[model samples]
Target: MYEGLMQKVMSDSKSKAGQYFTPRALIDSIIRLIQPQPGEIVQDPAAGTAGFLIAADRYIKDATDDLFTLSEDQGNFQRRQAFRGTNGCPTPTAFA
Candidate 1:
């Protein structure tokens, strides 16, 4: 859904929307270079559509299988500690 929406937006705006959406592969490469640790907070303060946060969350889960075995408290802490994104534009239509 977002892909189609992004395509339409980009086409309509003649590439102006490209600035707002980072390519997922580039996002993944940056996350790999940073190598976020388990307890460390990964935050994207100027997160547009939270692409970084989503990729980081996936990377962490793929790296750590302990998420399934952790106690409820530990799980809660991990969930809270990992991947925070702020200031995402609330409405997609607003971009248009």
Candidate 2:
């Protein structure tokens, strides 16, 4: 998983990664607190490796039973519009 990769990269070097990547635990905790829905617009401005955005999407999918509970339009929105990173960030999130 990309999260594993980032954690590996972080552990490999005591020095900080090129981009400021937040810890997965903290991100997941925040997502739990927020409880993002399928159609809400979620954007991370400083999306190093898109970790925050990815976690948010994962949280939403998990809550919605992998989007099975959502309507077609809501699922489409989750797939296309719910998760967003900054302009320079790569589209590295995996919804499934």
Residue 76, candidate 2: Cα error in Å is: 0.6
- The best candidate in terms of lDDT: 2
> How displaced is residue 59 in candidate 1, in Å?
0.8
Residue 79 error, candidate 1, Å? 1.4
Candidate 1: where are CA atoms >4 Å away?
1-4, 10-19, 69-72, 88-96
TM-score for each candidate, following the candidate numbering: 0.70, 0.71
lDDT by residue (17-85, candidate 1, tens digit) is 344566778988999998876667888876756778777877777777857656677667779866666
lDDT of candidate 2 over 1-96, digit per residue (tens): 676775665664524334445777898899889887777899876666677787888888888999999999989988988877764434332321
With candidate 1 superimposed using the best TM-score fit, by how many Å does residue 44's alpha carbon deviate from the native? Answer: 0.4
**Model 2 steric clash pairs:** none
